[model samples]
Target: MAATPEGYMSGFGNDFETEALPGALPVGQNSPQRCAYGLYAEQLSGSPFTAPRGLNERSWLYRLRPSVRHTGRFDKVDLPHWKSAPCIVEHDRPIGQYRWSPVPIPDASLTFVAGVRTMTTAGDVNTQTGMSTHLYFVTASMFDDYFYNADGELLIAPQQGALAFVTEFGRIGIAPGEICVIPRGVKFRVELVAGAARGYMCENYGAKFTLPNRGPIGANCLANARDFKTPVAAFEDREATSRMTVKWCGKFYACEIGHSPLDVVAWHGNYAPYKYDLRAFSPIGAILFDHPDPSIFSVLTAPSGEEGTANVDFVIFPERWQVAEHSFRPPWYHMNIMSEFMGLIYGQYDAKPQGFTPGAMSLHNCMLPHGPDAQAFARASQARLEPEKLTKTLAFMFETRFPQRLTDYAATLETLQEDYADCWAGLEKRFNGKP
Candidate 1:
């Protein structure tokens, strides 16, 4: 809410307090009987009230008008391409590894919500137990329209251009190598900062994403708390006709509103949107021998009800040094219980060095063996083990415990590489009885 737009408060999940106006935020109290500056006090809860202290999340907002006044009678709207979980569409393609070239940014205008093309989904949205992977091709910004998702929180990784998210909390600007997460039920509008924007989005329907535990690796070396930025208080106070859309229960509903919903003048709480730059992540790898499991590269993990297993893990392969000695390097062949939907943000992914371009995507479902392409395998096996830096490359994955099912739109997209499996075709059998 500060006059300095896009300013952020540092730290992850800290009870941040900010105000656009002096004394707008109450002192020593969350809600006062009489609010200051004639603003209304509202509570935004991200978790159940009785949830554990560490897990509970809630925010108190001082706004020009209460949120209830921001909407009218709702009507159903159609966003055909934005599919949700439990959306198993019939397809002819068999189960195996799949990859796609960049989904082209269309000439026609498309906003963030309008351009969402769901590629894969897992678990059930109704039960809030799964996630969805989507590619967004944004050509235009939302002017007088705003949207909020009731089904799940959104994690966005931009690959092509830049975006400015004006939310109820504040503004977060992200570019090709960064990500932002908008919490469930947070009203926000996406504005294109560059000509056109392309990105990968993950809709997490389970628990909110949290920094993964380091365990034996000790207290630091991954995503430090200070690097996860939450925007300061900022809001819009315009009076004009606007439309608000809600994605609830995997369906779309729209309502007419008299004014913009981004009117929070001040707020104090941990339940808000935040962003992270992939460049800041401190990656740890095997130094003496073989590489660690990909889980070692996890940036954030949304845990399931079970212990240890994750509902969704946001992992990244960023610019780093590869120095393992006598190791196969570049990810070794293996099958995972979790499904992986990976995308490149900027540079070449070391695994599929040939076709996995920036803005491209690859999907490997549960128990499906996948690893470096034939060329990558041959090159890594022959190259000398030294401290080599993988510069300017940023790739990421939305790995989930549930199997990812392809949407009809994705299954038949022309960009989907039909011969994706051929990347491994050149692998020669190297088994030797003498060895």
Candidate 2:
């Protein structure tokens, strides 16, 4: 796909090289004392210097100015609805299972950063573990402003409208059913592509999101690396006053700059922003008898240092075939160790078919018993055994090992469905103990 100043290269975490102008990049070494275009050489590290080669992520940038000039005296900024973790007692409401209707966009104009409303937060932001879920209702773009979150990387999922992300690396255009991830400390601005946009952002404070291991399933299917699109180098040398907002240690700080932070004329690195089309995800599922675990649908996972236990797992349930004979095609009723924050991009989710409309969200914390509501259970139980196709649906989940605590804004939102648990009321005792 095309972008404002550059195009995209296909790969996930590859050491890519790009230059907006010829010979802007270094010939051999990363830093050659003097850059080709009279630019400054800088290194951006996403991981530690001693990190393993596979895990090490750093980029060399040739910019018009060093990043040292991109800041001023930071002042505290208040983002009332943007919350972080460790403050568990946001409200006194009892939490069993919760769901919300589509949140209405506000009447007041809101920029991308101002539009963020935290729904749930897990783990500790200061400790750099766990993640948070946010609903963004954007009425305006960040004009003459940029934002970078030192707390975590942002995984954006557009549910309603399109968005154009102009980052230090390059520009990315994403629409519904497409997702893009901006690294933790990358400076970027958001612009509305098709008017006001609404989306979900999973702020991952743990390890950066990476493709899950296929293991026994082998390496061929499910979110192939070749499908990921990373933008090429692009920049502007124009001078203008701008505002920079930094989210560090659960607080916001504002900085003033004289020029765009995205003035990287050329870059070579494996640490940059990338986008992926959810439609291109090759899903692997239960082929014959039983319903497979939701891990099969994981598109990306941020590990929490434990084997097979992720700080956050980005899972999607897209259009696919249901052919499991002698089994409940919908998800079975069972409590899980991991907390789940779910959202519907479009169409009907197979579990909670009604009330869970597009842009709606639900939360089932760790060990919370939740599955198909009575309607879905009954429908799947009585349906024919023939293979059926589920079309035009895209539902996703941010499953985490840590329990997600509801934020005050989310706990008392007008969109919160007070009687969401009532959907399971119709699930009468169907067990007569008959073999």
Candidate 3:
């Protein structure tokens, strides 16, 4: 297979070293009294100083100036559309299973930051234990504007065009079907690569996302570590006016600067941005006679401290086979405690085949009764018992332990599918009570 054009260092959670300039990184010791090339040494810690060695995450950066000098005084700015958790906005709408068509790209200019529209929020941003789902419609790039979220890490899944993420560590290019994670407090700017870009984002305010344990599967399949790519060291040595933005506690703040913040000439650590291709995901499903739980399809999970429970799980429904004999292959009907917010990147999801279009989203909050719609249930029940391939389809779920509250913007959207319940209306009372 051809390497990604942007290039990447393989492996997950491995201490990687990259330098834009040769001999720029110091040997052995992380910090020397006087750094080479008059660079400033700074440590960026993703975890606490006393965190266990296995969970510790920190990186050493050799940059033009310390990060403290990159910002001035901060002034609070309002982003009405982008909201955070514990946000139970009062609305007339009832809480039930709901779906919406793809939000249209704005006709006016909207940068990545300005384009973020939060649909639902779970947990609390201040407590840092939940997540939020957002849709970004980027028509303009952030030329001199840089941003970092102090409250959470971002998992971006593009559905329209490509994006070039120029970060303090390096640059990562992502398109539809590929996802990139920017760790908390990593300054970066989004640049549009394939014109305007539209995508879904999961802002996790809990533990960082990690590959799930393979258990009895023995780690040979599902999301392999080698497929997760962290970018090579890249930086800019330019002098120009720039603005740095900070998103903390659900509020936005900006500071003016004289140079780009992405000035790191070299960096080494496991705490950095990385991207993964969904197509590279090796999916495991029912090969015999029963449908497994969706947890079996999880690509990454952010734990909630409790064992087996996730603060959030990023689960994908990628192309796979269906060979369960005398079984209803589509997901069975049930109410779940975990709130599920699902999105389709492309093709038809077997569960809700008709109304769930690409770029569309649905929310099935805690204990909400939902499953395969009438059309899907009918088809799966009558299909022949043979190996079938579900191709060209990709869907994902951002399921959380906490209940998600819809934002006012989401509830008021014109594209909201008011008739979403109709998909299940045809599921007749077929229980004959005669086994």
Candidate 4:
């Protein structure tokens, strides 16, 4: 089938229906006694059967073969770099603010799945209560290899290059400044469209990432629901010796298969992969004076079932106006209960104007004091109070309620800025009792 322009269907969480072949999908029923085109009917569920109707997520698929035909005897495999949670590797690294330069892409051949290097993990994967942050450096595409994670869904943020995700639902192409999410337990393979690709990935082990409730800001701004694009029904019917890998409970298992698993001719569901452009995000901040909390810039939030707390909040700081009168433009120095892992996509972040470059990252654990560096603070404190625009900057945070544990690979990376704390050294004590 030919690729569609924009190659996607719009809207988020809307039940969608698509069929590559005419009269392929069964009408009036999810499955029929006899299928059209001699295809098998299968159901994929993203939530429990007893879930509330509003939260229920399931999909019906008409494919060349049922998913049961996509596997054989399972054999354990090793993907050393892809670590999961409850993964606290003992190291000499201290518990404090840390920063790292852009990690160089590996020279050896690495596919999307094989290239995943876990930088930090929070909560526990076994209990399905936390998330893992990873950096992927892909140099090769999966030709006959396919993979799926039964543990959790993946939220991918591309910082460099583009990727074509060939999945059971359809094909989705994503590039830098864009994000794609693959639902848990969906079989897919990644093809590098830019020769090589580098990106950040968040594996959510709790609830799925959904649009945050816009109470006073209303529904029109901050990631409109219509902007999220889910791919239309498309599939490949190729017969060849193939391998399928499964990541379950932090362990990897491989199985042999004779054909591609992405053979779905038709599908109708709310549970599907989707992509969004980060530039489309509508930001709202303080209009008069004083800077609002970064929560106002949240693009999506995965709640931890507790009020005012998030399992993980995917927040971004994009290009916007700085017009707060008599205020410190950059973020202020304060300790937060929520742990933060920040990354730069392009341009400079106002908070750390010096060392934080694109593809670089910093971590501040729970209750850790962090804010504008010495230079950023001095400039913002003394600069004129006229209207200013922060152009060409895109920074984001993976803010979580759980403290993140550093992976051994992350702690040992040559890019780790050991002197990250020195940024606060220049803060002169201006305290005086006589006010």
Each prediction's RMSD to truth: 1.2, 1.6, 2.5, 1.3
Residues 244-315, model 4: lDDT tens digits: 999999999999899899999999989999999999999888889999999999998888879879999999
Error of 2 at 57 (Å): 0.6
Candidate 3 lDDT (Cα, 0 to 1): 0.91
Query: Tens-digit lDDT track for model 1 on 1-435?
Result: 222469988999999999988999999998889888999999999999999999999999999999899878999999999998899777898898999998888888999999999999999999999999999999999999999999999999998899999999999999988899999999999999969988999999999999988899999888999999999888788888999999999999999998889999999999999999888999999888898898988999999999889999999998888888888888889997999999998878888888888889999999999999999999999999989999988899999999999999899999999989999999989888785
- The residue-by-residue lDDT of candidate 3 on 1-435, one tens digit each, is 111235589989999998877888999799998888899999999999999999999999999989998888998988788888879889988889999998889887989999999999999999999999999999999998889999999999999999999888888999989999999999999989978889999999999999998999995899999999999887777678999899999889998999888889889998999999999999888877888999889999999889989999999999999888978899999998899999999998988879889999999999989999899998888888899899999999999999999999999999999999999899889989899
Residue-pair clashes, model 4: 0
Better of 1 and 3 by TM-score: 1
lDDT of each: 0.92, 0.92, 0.91, 0.92
The list of candidate 4 runs beyond 4 A from truth reads 1-6, 432-435
What is the C-alpha lDDT profile of model 2 across 177-247, one tens digit per residue? 99999999999999998788898999999999999999999979889999999998889775789999999
Off by over 4 Å in 2: 1-4
The pairs that clash in candidate 1 are 1-20, 1-233, 1-234
Per-model TM against the reference: 0.98, 0.98, 0.98, 0.98
